[model samples]
Target: MKIGKQDATYQLERFSKTQAEFDEHYEKDLQPIAEKLEEERQKTMSLAKEQAKKLIIPALVALAMIIFFDGFRIYVIAALAAYGAYLFKDVYEQRKKMRVKIKEQLLTALIQFLNPNFTYKPKSYVHRNQFIKSNIFKDDPNRYSGDDLIKGFVGNDDVDANGIKGTKTELSFSEIKAEKVEKYKDKNGKTQERVTTIFQGMIFVVDFNKDFEGLTTVVPKQKGLKISLPRFLSGEKGRRLEEVELEDMEFMDKFTVRTTDQIKARYILTPGFMRRLYEFATKKREVQPQNTQKPETLKEAVKVGLNVGGDQRRASQDARNVAYFSFRDGKMYFLLSTGKEHFESGLLTPINKSLVQEYYEDINKSLELVDELNLNLRIWSKE
Candidate 1:
């Protein structure tokens, strides 16, 4: 017995509707593109390491061959600087180009997966606040390549004067925006004043399973925005690098931090950092005579403050009045504390009302100005 023509038509229409629903609901089909981009990222990163290794190791080896072994002493330092700068330019630029290319390609690939014929045309560059007619480069003379260009723009005597009608900074420097502040607390509930106000930079090393997605680790759209330092910082010992502290919140007004409860609880040490420390220790330890000299460089200032030179090494986690946050489920937990001098001791997050009131008490009217058009701030420890 053959089915009726009308029945067959009805069945086909029902199947078409079901297919559309499935496409809208499930996105498993797009996984391959995401995974491919991640693979490309890994490959690109590996290539970068190879370049750095080739350049740095050979440069150091060449210097060693000329120095202690060949008595080239003082000149080795200069040679090393020149050689290091060249390799850095080549390798660093290449790695940077590759990353930008891959991320752009990844975005295109994602769009393609969503709509196969979506024909993505990537932008040449991502601008910071292009919606406004102002050029950020105009106000920040330092952002330009040369002092001459800046000097030419603002002639000798003109540079010293801030005349009202004189061509103002190329940018509308007056257009201020909202500022976000991260408040840290002691157990007794007092906020610690940062040693440095310009916490304009920080580096984060987030660890997860190799199978995990890289995008999950990135803080969203953070470039160019003013940043505040996080409450804590971490570091590696053997890299000749010192303290890896969180952003000095003193720098930015807004920030968003995330952590799962599991990651918060473990607070794992970076494996690569531990490996470097062990390797440096095991290698023929060079015992050098101690030289007492005052620091001249900015980094040296920090090293002296933290006692980071010679054999006197301290852990990044050793900084006092530090707080560590762990986000599990959805709640935040602050584990670190001020050493009996400040807080009562214990965790503090999503701070209580009493704590908030106490913090505002320290706020000075002159140091802070937050309105619709302006955001001004100048915070420091009270003497």
Candidate 2:
């Protein structure tokens, strides 16, 4: 599964291959790696089950003690937790080993298999500064960590930018978790700390085909009565952003825009551009294993929007409209709140063809954003 840098570079042109072609390539090139991974998967599951069986007797005894003798209940509960962790240490280590192997061997190959132009980094992430610069989320998060970084470019053969046909658009996305802590005094005068999640999802950044000045941010519209307010009036810092009203009713129904330059915002969000955004937001592109009774949890997040100050508490399944995007620095920053880690082999599931297909589909769906947003067509040159 070790792909040399030169080979990967040579295969950069394969980014345009269709899913059927990928399936053909997987069968021909990746079968051996998949078989080796299956062996590791089976061994890991057997070890986990053996460890689980050993815990049953002690767990039942602890449960009986808690039910019969309530005096030592708290101590027994704490002891049980400690004992469980100690007993499952081997299982945890085994699973971790299996996880890393899959990431290194199978996942890495699958990424390059899709597009060798793309580089997959399981340990690196998009920087928090880039997140801040996005200007989509107002609250700054103190804690941030991410992995499974995929970076590369895809060319639209039919589109032109500058003097060149087939414009190459750079795009990258990774799973990120950003959180902030707040300290507030309770009614009893004891200070308590609460950790609020600022944004927990995929941060997708892509090269904008057009050049525009200032920053334009589009976020999901607030429910109930509608009122547009300036960013400074609403306590936003830096650029003075004023809300831009659009003519499209459906676009207005789905989003609200704030921009430092009103003219550029209007120019960027044309009726066609707005329709593409709305269509992409509402599209049902969920990637799950086919025909599985118990599919892995790859469903869209209920609360995908930025939960600033712990304001958005309810889980909304129709968070398709819960997207955030902004234009700045010759790039379009897009955020999809898919609050789950994708493309990892399940511990209990076999690492077979279906698992590999699932991985392919997940990355493919994300890459589809390029086509969905029509990012390859240049609208205007930089001033």
lDDT per prediction?
0.27, 0.69
lDDT of 1 by residue, 217-296 (tens): 11212455332323222121231211222332321122233322223322322333223222322233112233357788
Instruction: Assess the local accuracy of residue 54 in candidate 1 as a C-alpha lDDT between 0 and 100.
Output: 60
lDDT of 2 by residue, 30-53 (tens): 778889878876776676567666
The C-alpha RMSD of each candidate to the native structure, in angstroms, is 26.1, 8.4
Runs of candidate 2 with Cα error greater than 4 angstroms are 1-17, 156-166, 187-190, 224-238, 287-321, 378-383
Off by over 4 Å in 1: 1-30, 52-74, 84-90, 102-383
Alpha-carbon shift of residue 136 in model 2 (angstroms): 1.4
Candidate number of the best TM-score: 2
Q: What is the lDDT of residue 220 in candidate 2?
A: 80
How does candidate 1 fare on TM-score? 0.24
